[model samples]
Target: MDPQLQHSVAESVATVVISHPEKRNAMTAAMWRALPPLLGELADDPAVRVLVLTGEGGTFCAGADISTLRGSPQEAQGLAVRAEEALAAFPKPTLAAIGGHCVGGGAQLAAACDLRFAEEGALFGVTPAKLGIVYPSSSTRRLVSLVGPATAKYLLFSGELIDAERALRTGLVDEVLPAGGLGKRVAEFARVLVSRSQLTQAAAKEFADGRTDRDAHWAAQARASGDTAEGVAAFLERRQPRFGWSVPTSG
Candidate 1:
């Protein structure tokens, strides 16, 4: 199938699938350009509490379609970078479900997510060095944030493929599961996220994203949202909290 970005929702989680079996789900320039808007639409959906990104045919993205690189290298790079930034800035929690090859730009997309889960035999690499090209500084920093500077340098400098065990050891992946049950596992986690208070999740996500000055504002916002009261009531009543709040629509 031709490469495309498609989304579906179930159990309050929007799953974005990258499909291009012929090329191991490598993204075309058009797919990259489509990502930000797709993510935006999902972000605006109040019912979608989380996002799960993955690839079809057992592989995550292999990278940008190199066959098209020679024709519009600059455009492809720009679109990919924009898509990465959009994913990183997505308001809700985003998870990458990696099954097979996640290399080059693929690694960037995975790093942009809030969490990453990979199958036990998945392979990962950053191949800019192999192509005599430079990795984007922003993506490099994100990689460093996940796996530390030294390990990030190792991947960038060597462009060598690492197994799931190595990726987990380096902090690149949060969980490693046996193949065939990845979707079930991710859905379980996403359901947990869906049941939680959006207020708390948004505040924590903002902090984790490196914004520290919003403490007072978030505290006020939380009080106004009434999630705290509902949570306390539910706890005392021995029932699950029915959180009604969603991220406020930005102006």
Candidate 2:
């Protein structure tokens, strides 16, 4: 059976699962093609506060399915880059809930996300060296920005997997959880995100993602949104803040 990208939503968080556990959830070409539209749908939804990417089975993605990897190299690479960019550019927060092996393209995907959480025993690698292919520049830069150039070279040059503790030490993953704790921690963090003002979060995400010149616009947006006033009122009233802001629908 072909691999699939499946998704579901609950309590303002959307979960996108990479489902091909027969090959340890390796993504097929079709799965690469499926990502952007699925992510766009979620990005356009007002109710979705955050997105979590994970695998269907115990293991996270084991990278691209080599057996089914047949297509024009340019087309295949283009599709993969497009999918990665979509995930990276998603307006809301994105997190990767990793377990087991997350290698090659899977590592690229995780790097595209804003944060990563992995189980203690999970393994991570960037394996273009093993396959005799060049890693994409964007992904390379993202990895470098996360882990620094030295560690990025260490991962890409060797193509050897590192355990979760090492991954955390190198800044590849934000949090490392015990075997059964990942899901709960991710859910809790997602809920915390859901409770924040979208206006504040979205602006902060944009700035952090390299938008260098939106000062006036962001200030105007914040003033008009009233999120600060509501937040202050809630603090003074000793009540939970109810933020009504949502991302604007993409045209």
lDDT string, candidate 2, 92-188, tens digits: 9999999999998899899999999999899999998987878889989999999999999999999999999999999999999998999999999
| TM-score result, candidate 1 | 0.97
For residue 168, model 1's alpha carbon misses the true position, in angstroms, by 0.7
Runs of candidate 1 with Cα error greater than 4 angstroms are none
Writing each residue's lDDT as its tens digit, candidate 1 over 131-216 gives: 88778889999999999999999999999999999999999999999978888899899999999988888889889989979999
lDDT scores of the candidates, listed in order: 0.91, 0.91
TM-score of each: 0.97, 0.97
| Model 2 CA deviation exceeding 4 Å by range | none
